[model samples]
Target: MRREIPLLITGIVGIVFVLQYFIPHFPFNRMNAWFSDWFSIVAAFAIWLGALNLMKISFQKVFRRKSDWGYAVVIIMSFLLMAVVGFAEGKGFRDQGTAFDWLFQFVYTPLSATMFAILAFFVASASYRAFRARNFEATLLLLAAFLVMLGRVPTGDVLTGFMPEGMRLSAVASWIMNFPQTAGQRAIMIGIALGLVSTSLRIILGIERSHLGGGD
Candidate 1:
C-alpha cells in the first residue's frame, strides 16, 4: 500500500499537470494550483528528510571519530545555527541584520564562494584530463574550449589581436553554447521525462519493486 499509493499519486499528478498545459480550463487549472500547494508541502517534508539524513550521517561519523568528523560537525552546527537565527529574527522569515542573516552573509557566503573557487580548480583539472589530445574529435573540443575561454577573458582580446575585423569568434562561442549544447540538453530532458513516465507507470502498476528493501 505504501509503495502503490505514492506511485499512483505521482502518475496521476504528473499526467494531470501535462494535460493541464494543453487544456487550460476547468478542473485542470484548479488541479494544477492545488498541486502547486501539494508540491510545496512535499518539498518542506523533503527538506526535513534531508536534514534528518544529514544529522544521521554526521552523528555516525562523529561517533566513529572518522577522518572528516570535524567537517561533519561544522555542517551540522551551521545548519542548526542558521535555523535558530532565522527563527529568532522573524516570526516566519529572517529579517535583514538578524543573527541568521549576518552568519549567512559573512560566514556562509564567503565559505560557499571559497568552496566554488576550490571546485573550479578541480573542474579545470578534470577538463584538462578529458580534453587531452588523444584524437581529432578531442583536439577540436580542446580548441573550442580554448576559443570560448579566450573570448570571455580580457587576455583573450589582447592575445587574439591578429584575428581579422570580419572574424566573429564571439558569435562562434555563443552559437556553440546555445545551439549544439542547448539541443543536447533538450534531448537529455526529453529522455529524462520519458524515463520518469515509464518509472511512474511501473510503480503505479506495481511492476517495479526495487524501492522495497527486499530485492525484487
Candidate 2:
C-alpha cells in the first residue's frame, strides 16, 4: 500500500498535467494552477529539508574534529550569518548598503570572478592537451577550435589582412557557428525533449518505480 499510493498519486498528477496542456479549459487550468502552487510549497519544504540535512552533517563533522572539518564550520557560519542578516533586515537586506548586499557584491562577486579566471587557465591547459591532433578527428577538432578562437580576437584580422574581407577567417568562423553549430544544438534539444517525454510516460504508467526507493 505504501508504494501503491505514491504510484497512484504520480499517475494521476501526470495524467492531469498532460491533459491540461491539451484541454486548457477553465476547470483544468484552475486545477493546474492549484497543483503548481502545491508544487511550489513542496519545493520550499524540500529546500529547507536539504539545508537541515547539510547542517546536521556539518555539525557532526565539526563535533568530531574530522579532516577538513574547518571548511564545514565555515559553511555553517556563512549560512547562519546570511540567514540572520536577511531575516533581521527583511526586504531591506536586498537593498544597497545592507550587510547582506555588501557581502554579495564585494565578497561573493569578487570570489566568483577570481574562481572563474583561475578556471579559464585550467580549461586552456586541458584544451591544449586534448587538441594534440593524434588522430584525424582530433586534428579536425583542433583546427576548428583554433579558427574559432583566432577569429574571436584582433589577431585574426591582422593574419588575414592580405585576403579579401569576405574570405577572412572571421567570416568562415561565423558561417561555421550559424550553420553547423546551430543545427547540432537543435538536434540535441529535440533528442532531450523526446527522452523527457519517454521517461515521464514510463513514470506515469508505474513502469519506472526506482523513484519509490525500493519496490518490485
Candidate 3:
C-alpha cells in the first residue's frame, strides 16, 4: 500500500503535467501551477533533509574514527560555522560586509577556484587522450578541434596571413563552429529530449521504481 499510493499519486501528477502542456487551459493549467508550488515547498524541505543527512554521516565517520575522519571534522566545522554566521546575520547575511558574505567571498570563492584550477589539468589530460586520431572519425574530430583551437588564437591569424581572407584557417574554423557544431548540438539536444520523455513515461507508469528506492 505504501508504494502503491505514491505510485498512483506520481502517475496522476505526471498525467496532469502532460495534459497541461497540450491543453494549457483552465483546470489542467491550474493543477500544474498548484503542483509546481507543492514541488517548490517539497524542494525546500528536501534541502534541509540533505543537509541533516550529510551532517549525520560526517558525525558517524568522526565517531567511528574512519579513514579520512579529519575531512569529516572539517566538513562539520565548516557547516556549523556557515550556518551560525548566516542565521545570526538574519536577512542581510549574504550582503556585503557580513561575516557570511566575507567567508563566501574570501574562503569559498578561492577554494572553488582552486578546485577548478586542479581540474583543468585532468581536463587537458582527458582531452589529449580523446583527441588522439585512432580512426577516420577520430582524425576528423582531431582536425576540427585543432582548427577551432588555432582560430581562437592570434597565432592562427599570423600563420594564415599569406592566405586569402575567405580561405584562412579562421574562416574555416568559423564555418565549422557555425554549422557543424550547431547541428551536432541540436541533434544531441533532441536525443536528450527523447530520452527524458521515455524516462518520464516509465516513471509515470510505475515501471521505474528506482526513485522510490526499490527494485522493479
Candidates, ranked, lDDT: 3, 2, 1
**Candidate 2 collision pairs:** none
Query: Per-residue alpha-carbon lDDT of model 2 for 1-216, expressed as tens digits?
Result: 999999999999999989988887888878878998999999998999999999999999999999999999999999999889889889778999898998889988998999989998999899999999999989988998898888878888789989999778888788778888899899999999999999999999999999899758
The residue-by-residue lDDT of candidate 1 on 1-216, one tens digit each, is: 776666677667766777888897798868877888988999988998888999999989999999989999998887888887787777845568677777878998998999988998999899989889899989988988887877677666566567873355665567678888789899999999999989867765557757754433
For each candidate in turn, the TM-score is 0.70, 0.86, 0.88
Mark the regions of model 3 whose C-alpha exceeds 4 Å error after superposition.
Answer: none
**TM-score of candidate 3 versus the correct structure, residues matched by position:** 0.88
| Alpha carbon deviation, residue 147, candidate 2 (Å) | 1.8
The number of the candidate with the highest lDDT is 3
Give the best candidate by TM-score: 3
Query: What is the Cα-based lDDT of residue 18 in candidate 2?
Result: 94
Q: Which is superior by TM-score, 1 or 3?
A: 3
- lDDT of each residue in 22-108, candidate 3, tens digit only: 896788768867888989999998999999999999999999999999999999999999999999999989999999999999999
Model 3, global lDDT: 0.93
